[model samples]
Target: MVWRALRPAFALWIWLAIGLAPLAAQPATEDTEDLLQKAMKAAVARVAPSVVQIETSGGSDILGSGPGMFRKGAGPTTGLVVAADGYVISSAFNFANKPSAIFIAVPGHKERHVAKVVSTDNTRMLTLLKIDAKGLPVPVAAPKKEFRVGQWSMALGRAWAGLDTPPSVTAGIVSALGRIWGKAIQTDAKVSPLNYGGPLVDLQGRVMGVLVPASPRGQDETAGVEWYDSGIGFAIPLEDINAVLPRLKEGQDLKKGLLGIYLKSTDIYSVAPEIASVGIDSAAAKAGIKAGDIIIELNGQAIVRQAQILHILGEKYEGDTVTVKVQRGKEELTFANVRLTGTLSAFIHAYFGVLPVRDDPELGEEIRYVFPKSPAEASGLKPGDRIMKVGLAGSPMQPFSGRDELTQLLDALQPGTELTLEIMRKGAKKPETVKVRLGVMSDEVPEDSLPEPATLKKALAPRKVAPRQGPPIQPGQPGPRPGRPQPGAPRAEEKKEQPKDEKKKAATGLLKRMTPARDHEYWLFVPEDYDPNIAHALLIWLHPAGKNKDKDTEAVLAAWEDLCSENHVIILCPRAESNAGWLGSEVDFVQQVARDVLAEYTIDRQRVIAHGLGIGGQMAYYLAFNARDLVRGAAPIGAALSNQPKDNAANQRLSFFIITGAKDPLAPAIQEGKAKLAEHKFPVVYRELAGSPQYLDAGTLQEMVRWLDSLDRQ
Candidate 1:
């Protein structure tokens, strides 16, 4: 058996030997390690003069808020002299701490010169500083067209040594390109705070890119700062920066361009870029792009997925005109010269003031309620009309047929635009087409004539208003009610009232505490008398910025407890990440908290409200606008709108209850924001305080509670 196994092994070895014999006899190539080492030294010598050291002193340890949030590092940073006219460029992060004094040290100089900030490119995370002297060494940029992966890259910095000392260098290869959505190039070089603001040079010492902290996840001064010393690093190509140098020198802050369309699908991999909601005043709307239009190509690049669009246009700035080709239904449409904008005119939702009855899931929505003075009423649409199709008589866009689709369509068109609606009245044999001009959504709350929500009535029908408590009636004590007998001593009482079902406690009275884990750690207050069976209103309290968060939580609970107990309200207060305060990114955290409460407790979707005061109030407005699908009511006290909100027809159902103090510093802006919102036709209930509000009186708190309860009204 051993001999048989050895025979098979020997035969396999002989076959391998035959296969490798010809290759093993070939000659080897010469070594290039020493040659490459000498070349690298020469390259560093060629580029060292352009690099400089920047030192700062006497500033706060931490810088700006959110993405710009910075922690002062221990060492000086590196910068590249970009021009001979005394203009030097460095990472924006080097100055993020806002040092009281800035000084620059050039190569081979024993003394330093005070440098002044010239202009900053916020988008690229670069800053230009000016000195008194000119004739600085300016590095030559390698042509970007010649860029390729696997090419040698050397990252140089002046972090460790004096101006006369050789600069520190890390050598690696270009790992990728068009990173950070085409804004950066990728390399495997060791990059960190030590080398940031320096240059990534080629084999011949030609500058390829300016190194800055970056990551695929974000674009910010400190976004990639966390990855210090990691092999992965980013450098903005000098070729791209040179193209934008003129604009940067003009001191214009670059803003990301906006298309203003919310897509229908969240699937990142397979879903094409399809418009679900178009802001009425957005570039997309201005270019006549409609819902259901699939973006086929952006600029000149073919886009197969939503991410492809982001990759192509993510780095584009406002005022950039992009030609787009879209597939609308079966037709291919081209829209050329769609100029993007960083800002848009305020969007106001056009309204028809009609509520659809949601009785059958399979049928088109039927009209259940129509406001007296709305476009629906003016067009002679009745309460029982079933909407079938919606659009203009002759238009390129197809007629929208679904209830939700119709709502999006109406919101896309501005007020006073004519729309043709195909509707079938109760007794009609066929659908009739009628012309209805869109109407502005009013800021006023719906009148009392609107129908009561059947769900609310159904939930409240079984519960009896528990009588107020008092000292237990003694045998001879008079009854609490005007004529009722005492509980234990009354002979006329037909029977002792059945014991109250205290077991089924409702959220009422004092607020109960809860804690949930999220990006924004939050405190929750559920009224003690809250009913688990019936849906309750949830109020997310955002307070003005200040220290003493524990006190803020207490105050929010104290102000809303009685109203909460009486009306079944739960309050959630999410604290800012740090004392530096609120960030636009925190909006996601707030939404997570709301969804958590909704999931863990019984909460009313239509009665979900965002209420805040001071900075908290501004955040409340921010939360409501960012989480439009979750919030039904926004009640802010003495805060202006955070930014112009995107207009949508489905969210037209949103309502606002704003209280402003005429004497308040932000009062005018608040009123203007309210006016802009009202123009979009959002139902707004405006309340004016004689002056600015120092406190919310008991009466006002009660009124706000009533507004939240009424949020469910048709």
Candidate 2:
């Protein structure tokens, strides 16, 4: 038996020996580590001198005052000098609100000069600053359309790695590419909080990205701890910067293209379809496109993936034309010569003394209604009309479609010029063509001009209003009259109590309701025995961290009922977006809600108060500091404040009722906050809970309620 087994094993061993002999002879490749280091050093040496140290002196707020006074100095912020005259591109997160002084450190020079904030592209999270220095070398501008993955990249900045030193340099490779707006290039470089606004350079000494937030793990490594680099720092792609830089430098207003529709992807292999619509007056509606339309092509090329649409459109310039093909059901159709429309960015850029069109999702086909006496309007263009072609003075007529071409055209045009506009309006059989003269400056305004009462009112006007559907009428409260129709409501039921005179008038004009009022306003809650003629105090209560849900509302309402019964104040608990909680669009939405409430109701502005729990408290702090003019006082519980510094005046005007848990780690920070606030003369009332500081449960509910109530009563 042993001999038989050995015979089989010998045969197998011989086969293995033959395979192993060939594998062992394979040769190895040379190491590329040296090449990588050389390339990195070359890239750094080239772009480092072009990088500047940004020092911002921001105003610190004590309480909610007015605009706080500002001071200046350099901490550690990184910026890329993109122009020969020393224009640096930095992140806007570093410059919140308008501050007094922004200075950039010139390479090899001890002098620092004040830099002017040229423009801020909020959507892109980037800002451009101009320093008066001359003869500075600007990095080679990158093309805005493409960037490949696995590209070699370097980062240079004054990194605040520790309190002991100034900014320094860090190197890494591009880990990935094709990031969305508000995101950065993912690189292996070590980016710290101090590296914010720094430039990412490539081997050719050109800026490839802007250094932004990196992985947070490596900070403790300085203590000899073993933390590793995340290799995931992001940069603002040089392409987006290149596309918008001309407008930023020329102080020209940019015009971004507007596509009147919203889109979502479907499983259809051959085409992309519109799953739903967001608004009616959007650019899509103006083009006569509807929900459920299947899109097959753009500019005569078939579109396979949905991801390419936004990029393709976002790149176009205002006034450019595009051709789109769609299939509605089994019917194939094409819409050609669609003109790109300018949006909010155009106006925002105009104000920064930069000229660039902003792409606003809010500005649909109705954009014609808002254009500021510009060439397009002078040429007889109307809102909801689609432009098909644009004819420049000395060039052939070109199709003005797609966001990129549109934005470029708006940036490329001279102040005074004549241009032809080809337009098509819904309900029209043939396209109407007209000519308009371009103006030197497009109608762009500054951010300060945004809060104008008229503008706010116009922006908030209700697009439609109708009587609300409600439960059956009770005895005392107003409900549908037994025999008469309610105002603004259709007559589905006949009434027996209709007066003879009321009946006669209803017979004549009941078919029509008074022109829907200019605005439709709804009150979330009204106090019992409320009167329209009597002025009332309005309390805008922001929900606590988790009170944004149905259960949360019930609990809040129960507590509010107890307070409102005695205070007789109108309580408005405006619903917040579930995803953004309080930080999302909450501020803007709240501002609008407040304005809407004031316009529709007799609100005592002087008595208006803002109060919040956790997330709500954060919001209260935000408004108290940013929109002090709109609020009277604030109360925040178990909520932390934003790290961004606030102004002294806005802080002063604010009166805070702060509540926190005794064991809360943030309590010490809150005490330190109180001392800082004391410097601004802001009044504060603080309460410390003994146990878990998370929220206002039953034990602490009364104190929280009473504290908020006292603000109005006092």
Candidate 3:
């Protein structure tokens, strides 16, 4: 039996060797080609009996929108029979719409069997189905050790109708091994919805893996569906699936194991596995892991870079035990049998009750505004009080230099945790220590007007100019006007000389007809006195359908001019190609424009926001969720949430500022959306205007600006 199993593998190797041999030493061209063709056909015939056709009836038209969206077709999908007693496996994406009924047709079987989903492996995005049938043909699984990059492989699917119809076959070579963080094999063969749950077989007809859509970045069921027929395809190795088949058979849905530790750097390739913060009540925290420890090994695998740790843990499922080793100050610690969990407590951003003044950290983190009924308020902490140091109670206080450092400290703690702060008042000689308990972030807007930020305050301050001492100008020559340009003056002919580099200097003030690329146009408004030294916030404005005309652009600029300058923000309004409305496909164009602006200007990454109304507001939600790496906040005025919001994460923090009128038609939906975000533990600020209106009022606009400015608050 062993030799029978090994014979095909040896023949495959010999065939491959001949195919790759030098031209002079190769076999006859026609004979070799004929043999390859015959082998491919035989392989497909061997696996065709195990392939099944699945048809789902009654489901939603499409799942949400944007990059992660999934659309179900009205045709049948493919599945693989994994057991003799009617156990089958298919991609979870085929049933993402929660179909009302599922029917599976086996080859040579005249009747179709009704099937029900037994369980799912969320980590690999695979689903197992059970049908009341017997003696199903189970395909043989190829050994993992036999898989080689460049080996000939064929993908077979039974998506086509009719019991006598042959399975569809696509032949290619294995592109890679241990891909998708060691969970899948990469293939050059075309894979799509048609063959998602079909078998990828070797030249000998043994099953190599099960085809599935997967992405390294996203874990949703339909995450990597966008890469269909793109030469880059993924298949989970059969051996890996078999190892967890017993658990899945027991009706226990599997989830990706989470360590619940945020790293210090987002660059996983070059950075060491250094912990920045551990989620409260997380598996890592329960295992006694703390912040600042550098992980050196996990599950017996040496972890040098952060990516290595991810790869090691990517294949792990909930309830699995892993051993972790980390290096502290001068000692190495090893934690054994640390069981992983599927879910961690949703991260609630702890509130310290004070907004730090931007760009004014010379003495320490100087407070710009203190929230009412907050920890700082209860402790008598006021604006202009610089925090010198902060730490947990009974711990050594660590001095911080700026708001960023203070934020890091606060992020490592949870709500209800007691803290000690060393505060230096505006006119105090000595610092005073205050004790306060942290609380959950508030959603209410401050009723009182907020003090100006540092930049605006400096801009508004009166300047003292020295007496002019230049050579006396002739009567006809332009006089030296101190801090002023005389009107109707010659102005030295206002040199229009271009820089030698020919790179167009970024223009300030309202800029119209700005085209980032061919067939794409947007209007940008940069503060007239924009400074590269001072980081500015970015607000991407999506105008309502049919409201992206020149007049509308001008009205937006007119309304936001003073606010942008005062708040150090830049306004970007992208015009849709069609005046009717925005399309889901346009998200890429909008994202590209936002990237161009971020690259060209010194934008504060933490304060980047997406704002819009009506249809535009829906697009804003799409961009914010799809482009989580770029946008930190979203303000959807008079727009209801169209797509479900992702769970909040400590590293990729996202906040929402939702505004709707009391009598607006979307008020109820908007309120429900706000509740959803809050339930996900995302910080949300919701406001309801007095009357029905298509746009924000002056007071609401100002309040929205305040919300944007405070996004960086810890």
What C-alpha lDDT, on a 0 to 100 scale, does residue 477 get in candidate 3? 15
Q: Residue by residue across 10-65, what tens digits does model 1's lDDT show? A: 21111110111121211221123334445667777788899999898877786432
Candidate 2 C-alpha lDDT tens digits along 1-714: 222322222211111101111212112211333343445556556666777777766644222211111222236667877778768888664565456788777777668879888776544556789988888877775543445555555566664432123235555556676554223467666654456677777656677777654221111101101112344567777766776898888764345466654443222243344423322343555676654455678777777655556546655656668887877656767878877665411111000012111111121112223244555655666545655555554433444322222332332233354655556775688977676655543212222221111111121121222122242111111212233211111112211223446433212100111113423222255556543333345677787644566566556666667456454456667666553356433465676777655655545443467777766777777677655546656767766654433333211124566778887766777676666655444556667888755556664555544433333210
TM-score pick, better of 1 and 3: 3
Each candidate: RMSD: 16.5, 21.1, 11.5
lDDT on C-alpha atoms for all candidate structures: 0.67, 0.50, 0.77
What RMSD does model 2 have? 21.1
Q: By TM-score, how accurate is candidate 3?
A: 0.84
What is candidate 2's local distance difference test score? 0.50
Ranking by lDDT, best first?
3, 1, 2
Q: What TM-score number comes out for model 1?
A: 0.62
TM-score for each of the candidates: 0.62, 0.43, 0.84
Off by over 4 Å in 3: 1-28, 66-70, 361-363, 456-506, 512-522, 543-555, 574-596, 614-619, 638-644, 660-670, 688-694
Alpha carbon deviation, residue 482, candidate 3 (Å): 42
